[model samples]
Target: MSTIEEIQAELRALTEQEDEINESLDALLQERGVLEDQLASLHKLMPNLGLIHNDAKQLTGMISFTSQLADNVSGKVRQLDLAKSRVLAASLRVEDVLDLKFCTEGVQTALHEESYEKAAALIHRFLSMDEAVLQLSEDAAEGSSLKQSFTTLHEAAAKLRSLTHSKFDSAVNSGDVASVERFFKIFPLLGIKEEGLTKFAKWQSAQTSTQIEV
Candidate 1:
């Protein structure tokens, strides 16, 4: 081929290469436009994402604080309940001690005065108390004051019982109908029912024998 024909063929090939390069440039520009649009969308969402992150942190902190507060409140409530129980128990113990003291003093006074009914009533009240609880109260007391009080009451009861028995027997022997009847009624209160009934029967028999003799 001649030199000019070769040059013309090379020029035609260059034109085809330029067209391909222009097409490639156009495609790259379109791709760049799409990437820019996506980047802009991401930028628009950035502030909302930041707000959500901060809100999540705040919510987590609130939950942690609420849990701690609940734990503290529950612990305080349990402590209050324990304290209340202790106070009630202490009050009951104090009341029991007071009752024991009052009964002891009242029984002694009644027995000294020869108030048999009053003494018996006090004794009955004493007997109704819970022995085990009274024992616990005595143990908690400062000294043996409670013990002494108990001993005094027991002694007074024995003395009163002996006195009633002797007086009833003496009254029956003397034929004092008033004294005999009064002591007989007091015997059941003193917890000597059978002995009182036997003594009464003997008095009736003696009275019958005297009437038969007369």
Candidate 2:
């Protein structure tokens, strides 16, 4: 019942519609291909991104450990420094005590041997030791035994000085020239050189006057 022209017109319209659908299908397939490429790229990068995350975690852990270790090392260093200071202080204290003991003993031996010069020198050294100990902190000096020993040595030195003066006077009065000369050598040791010389000169003048009268 359709005319030939009308059939041709409908057929042409159908063909155009089919062409549009085919074009749309081809565009959709191209877009799908692009999406697939993007998905593939993301899959390839996934392991590297996971590795970066793990590395970051490990780095944070390492940083934390290092901080703790540094703190421990600093504490240990402070403890060692304190220990070394204590050891050095103890050694110095011992040395000070020993020096005082040895010098006191030396003075005693010199006085016993009648080595007046040596004894005087040792006495001077003992005086210096006393001064050094006195300069220490009050608590430290109180704890030291050197304080008592210093008192004993001071008393002994005084007694020896008195005995020396008496002996020197006796020899000069007796006109014992040899004894006087021998003791004269010790006058400077006793820090009385000028006094001893003046006395000896007086004794010599008196002897000259007595001889002229004879």
Candidate 3:
């Protein structure tokens, strides 16, 4: 499978296709659910019809029961077929979504390790960077207090801003883990009591593990 960046790029290019596929699958699922409901309704009706047919003394009662059964059975079969088609389409869409989701996981991992090269592949993905960018826009960024979430990445980003306006870009562009590690060490708030930093460190570890090409 493609990396997260690659998959995201592909998804952008094939948005229409994905939408069509999803719609096809969704319609089928909804139809199937309706059919299941109808089937249950028919089951309930059948028992009632059985009681009436056995108790009725008139010929009209037998004819009415047979006609009702015929209508219900025929309608149920048609509904069941429609429902089956919807379920099949939904299964296919699930596969497509999973494939794309796997790719997303890869890109997220790269960002955790500060792999700017991998992260920068999809310009669209940067749309998600706004919060991080705006929050760090203040050149006087100090490390976030332990009270905030993502304290480690935030602190690292701030120290990065202090070092250079483009420190993260430069270090990540160089593609050296040692430099990345050094950058992390110098990031603000490492000396603070924030557990967010400790938690962000786990993402970094996971990224490093995935970075092994083999």
Off by over 4 Å in 3: 1-13, 55-214
TM-score for each predicted model, relative to the true structure:
0.51, 0.45, 0.21
Ranking by TM-score: 1, 2, 3
Q: Please report the candidate that would top lDDT against the real structure.
A: 1
lDDT per residue as tens, model 2, 1-214: 1899999999999999999999999999999999999999999999999999999999999999999999999999999999999898767766666666786788788878977767766655655553564446325545556667677677756765676676678887887878777666665655566867886788788879999999
Relative to the true structure, how large is the alpha-carbon lDDT of every model?
Answer: 0.82, 0.75, 0.54
lDDT computed for candidate 1: 0.82
Error of 2 at 9 (Å): 34
List candidate 1 segments past 4 Å from native: 1-96, 137-139, 209-214
Best by TM-score: 1
After superposition, which runs of candidate 2 have C-alpha atoms over 4 Å from their true positions? Answer: 1-43, 114-144, 152-214
If both were scored by TM-score, which would come out higher, candidate 1 or candidate 2? 1
Write candidate 1's Cα lDDT for 113-168 as tens digits.
88877887776666566757667755644448777767776776677779879888
Give the TM-score (vs. native) of candidate 1.
0.51
Q: Write the per-residue lDDT of candidate 3 for residues 114-170, one digit (tens) a residue.
A: 664443332123223334433443223323431132343444334434442245335
Worst 10 residues of 1 by lDDT: 134-143
